[model samples]
Target chain A: MLVLKNIGVTFDGGTSIGSTILNGINLRVCGGEFVIIIGGNGAGKTTLFNVISGLLRPTTGQVMLDGKDMAKIPAHERSQYVARVVQNTMAGTMCNLTIFENLAFAFTRGKRRKLLPYSTSARRKIFAEKLESLGIGLEKRMNATVASLSGGQRQAIGLLMSVLAPSKILLLDEITAALDPKISDSVMALANKIIVAEGRTTLMITHNMAHATAYGDRMLLLANSHFQREFSGPEKEALTPSELAKVFGEV
Target chain B: MNTLEIVSGVEIGLIYGIAAIGICLTFRLIDFPDMTCDGSFVLGAAISGILIKSGCNPWLALCAATLGGALAGLATGIIHSFFKISNLLSGILTAFMLYSINLRVMGGVPNIPLIGAATIFSGASAIAVLTCTCLTVVAIFTYLLATDFGLALRSVGQSKGVSTNYGVNIRLANAVALMLSNALIGLSGAIFNQHQCFADISQGVGTLVIGLAAVMIGEKLFPCWSYLLIVPACVVGSIVYRIFIGFALHSEILGLKTQDLNLITGLLIIIAMAAPKFRRRSC
Candidate 1:
């Protein structure tokens, strides 16, 4: 479970230009809950994820991960508690490393790194099995450089990597936004299945309203630097894109 | 070549190979084309020469040299990371400053002579049957790289975002990588000073080019997927590159003087840089 209590983030644009990105925002995700956040441009959605992932520290409140205050933890130290996928496909994997090597790195996440001499074969086999579960042909290309992977393939791998470690929370920041619709659907379906099967708590941000409605158990909308609305179950299902848009004054 | 010449060439090659591996590690794993190797190379030599002349043991001198290199690298890493300086600029600035630092370390000398001091390769064949020894060190390094920390460092080079997502301390990784890289370079410098019986500050000049050349040559020759093969190939490539340079300098046909070494190095770098482009065209 994760909780953000009365979080606020302020930016000093200049001596004269001061702006607050998030103001008194509160959010909670129970264990095994899937939360989709829908927002238009500049809705502080990504900022919220950034705050949660320890990329940005909130000025006013605390970020509690499993009841521990995590606002002071550095981004790299947060890997043990949170794993995230960014909108940029290349942001989630090392492009120069082979698929299996990347997975090996992921498997050893949140641990002290050492130099061990062993053939990558054993680890490659394990990664292959995991890849096969994604139903992606990445299992066969364990030795392939991530540079050669398609955007969708990379995103799928990124999703899988985030869940590879036993982190308490997974953050998806429009991870499939760059892929083609078909690939996007496939990646989403895979993510849905993986998150559900693993029973991992997830907070996914999306530009697509339909995805917000269809994928997760809960939905929240951001506007004016705060959560403007929250919906769940049948209420979230009954809401249409136009109605959702109206709530944010987009319609 | 005669056995003696072959042995000498191989020994020299292995020494350079160690430096090349250090250079390649910073390049491939940290994604930084760190030029501090040039200054750190000389720094190592200077430190080792001073210590050895002062009656320090050869191993202790080598350790001191490695530490000196690590400090130099740490300085460069701090300038780059904290000051938001570009990688290339950070290396260049640090290397430039190291010229003065090396001078201070050597008590204002342009070079230091080892004279009768012992070296790691002392009593070794000109053919340097030290391959087995070098291989052991290489194996240890390779194994360390396969560990989680090494993977994190590699990830930093590959993708900063991903590495951070995995909670890899990028700044720490960068610092450690640079330190390790320069430490190895320093070790090579110490060895080189002992082998030649002298350490010249100018020896570090164009060292980065030599390292890049070795890496380029290794990738060209082996072009393998495995790090085990690629790492050794880099060492071999460094030696081969050195041999070719040495032969070119020694050849009567070239009519080149020792003072023209920098000119020759520059030309070699141009050729190396262009080789990939030429290969693309041919393909």
Candidate 2:
């Protein structure tokens, strides 16, 4: 379970030079629930995610993961329970490393890295199987540097790396915003499949109404640093893109 | 150049290769233009030379020199990571501070002649020592790069965001890399002092240029190779660079002198940098 209670984030140290980015934002996500959050520009959606993931500490609030207070945790330390994938194609992965190298790194996420063998045959086999399961034939090019891959492929690898972590919650920040429409839909499908299969709590931010309405078990409309509306179960399942577009219009 | 001159070039080149590997670790892998190598190199020589002169074991002197270099690297890492200073400026600051420390290490003397002193390879043939040491160091470095710790170091270099997101201790990785790199460089300085039987505070001048030249030459020579192969490739590149200088020094045709060493190195670097562009144009 992930919970955000009365979260508020203000830029510029909230002192002489400051602007409130998030205000009294409260949210809770249970295991096996995929929450899709949509907002217009300057909606504080990203800041909310950052606060939840411990990248930015909120001025007033508490972040709880599995009923434990996570407000004091640092970003890297919080990664033990929370994994995040950012929007930039280049942000979530290392370009100088090979696919296998990247996977090997992800395999040790939130864990102490030792002088142990990085390319053990068993670990290699497991990574290979994971890649093969993607059905993208990436297993054949494990040795190729991430710099040589396409944007879609890079994003795929980013998602793959995030899921492989021993995380209780997955936070995605516009994961497909950089890809083409076709690739974006495919990635969405892959993410949905993985989230359901893993039964992990997920929070995904998207700008596209179709994506917001098409996937996830719940939908949230955020505006002016607050949750304006929420739909779940039958309402979320019956939500339409036109209804989401109307919400955006009102915002 | 005669065979003896060529052999001398190879010997010195291999020694420089070790230092160049250290430079490569930061400049290429971690994207840090670490100027700490300049002062740390001389620091190593000063410490090693003084230790040997005090009748300490030669092996112990070398180890102490390596540790001194690691300390220099750690200082730079601390300033860069903790103070939020730019990486280049932090290295420069550390290098500047090390000069005073280095002079003190050598008893306030700018030069220390280690003649008749026990050295790490005092009884061995110079060429044999160079060959054996180069092979072992290169092998160990290559193996290190193939480990999990190495991957984390490289990851931080590639993307700090990704590294942090995945729980990689960025500061720790940076410090570890700089320590290892400077340790190798200090080893080079120690070995060079032993081989030449002298240590001078000014010996580290233009050290960065030489290492940069070697790394560029190595990358030019072998653009694609495994991690292990790439390391030895750097060593070979360093040797070839020294050979070019040797040929220029012994020139019977160009009327070149030893004093023109810097000019020739600069020219070679220019050529190396432009080679790929010229190749693409021709194609």
Candidate 3:
């Protein structure tokens, strides 16, 4: 389980040399539950993600993963328990590296990077099979560099990479923002499939209302430096894109 | 030019090729502008010279020089990552500090003569010795860049965000890369000092430029995308560059003298860098 209690972030800039970006946020995500957070510009959605990923330390309160306080842990160490996929397609994957190489890197995530060759026959077979599941024929092009792939293809590969390693929590930070609507739908579907198959606790933040309502077991609206509303079960199932949009504008 | 001049050029090229490979690692692979190359080169020479003069085994002295270079790289990495200094400035600062360190290593002397002291080249032919050493270093690095750690290293250069998310310690990777890069440069410096029978503190001047020229020339000439080919290309480019220099020095017809080497090298790098742009514009 991943839990955040009384988390707050204040940027060191502005009239008073500080401005609050996030405040008094409390969240608890159970194992295998998918949570979606929706927010407009400057609503501190990314900051909240950063705080959970240990990229930013909260001004107050605690981030607990499996009942262990992780506020002091660095991002790289926190990654052992949490896997994140960012919005920038190029940010989540190494473009210059080959598809096989990129997958190989994710395959050994959180593990010691030994001096041994990363791609053995056995590992290569596994990577190819994983790519094959994407239905994009990336398996046949394992030797091709990621830079040569399209944006949607790269993001798909990025999503695959995050789930390749075993982790308790997966944070998808607007990962489909750069892709077209159709591509984003497919990527989201793949995400849902992976989350169900692996039963991982996931937190996905998005600006797309449709995506926000379509995939999550629980949905949270973040505005004015805190969660404005939380919907789940039948309440979340009854949420429509227009109603969510109206609520977003009202806040 | 006589056959002897060509032979000497090849020897110098092979020795300096190791430094060029190091340059490729920092500048090309890791995207770090490592100015530490200049001082580390001299550091290598000084360490090897001091040890060899003190009657230490020449091979052991070479190893020490390599480690000394790695330390210089580590210093830069620490300043950059730990202290939050910019990469370029961190390298410049380390290079500045290494000047005094190199002088101190040579016991306050700016130059040391290795003449009459048994060196690695005591009996081995310069060509045979350098070729063997260069091949060995190249093979080892090729194997290194093909490993899991190599992937992590390259990923850190490509995207720090993804590297962190994947559990890579960016600072540690940068440090390791710089250490490996400077170690190779140090090896070349030690070889150069032994080959020339002297270690001059000023010999490190323009070392970075020379290495850059070799790396650029190799990539421009061979134009391969794979690191596997790019690694060897560094050596080939160094050899080719040295041959050109050899020709320029002997070309009285062109009114070129040995002192004009640096001037021509700077111009050559500019032309090489701009040529691709010109080609693309024309196309």
- TM per candidate comes to 0.92, 0.96, 0.97
Pitting candidate 1 against candidate 2, the one with the higher TM-score is: 2
TM-score of chain A of 1: 0.94
Top candidate (lDDT):
3
The DockQ leader among the candidates is 3
Tens-digit per-residue lDDT, B107-138, candidate 2: 99998998888887778888898999999999
Q: Residue A233 of model 2: what lDDT?
A: 55
Expressed as tens digits, the lDDT of each residue in B1-283 for candidate 1 is 3556656777777878888888988997678989899999999999988887777887788889988999988998999989999989999999999999999988888877877666665677634445764686588677767676667777888878888888788888898999989988898888777778888889887778777788778877887656666578778888788777778777888898778877887788788779789999998
Q: How are the candidates ranked when ordered by TM-score, highest leading?
A: 3, 2, 1
Tell me each candidate's RMSD, in Å, in order.
2.6, 1.6, 1.5
Candidate 3 lDDT tens digits, A149-217:
999999999999998999889999998899999998888888888888879899999988888877889
Candidate 2: tens digits of C-alpha lDDT, residues A52-106: 7778889988999999999778888888888898999889898778898999998
**For model 1, how does the per-residue alpha-carbon lDDT over A114-224 read when each residue is reduced to its tens digit?**
656323667767787999998877888888998899999999988888888888999999987999888988898899999999998999998776677789998988878
Candidate 2 chain A: minimum summed lDDT over ten consecutive residues — where?
A231-240
Measured against the true two-chain complex, the DockQ scores of the candidates, in the order shown, are 0.67, 0.79, 0.82
What DockQ does model 2 achieve?
0.79
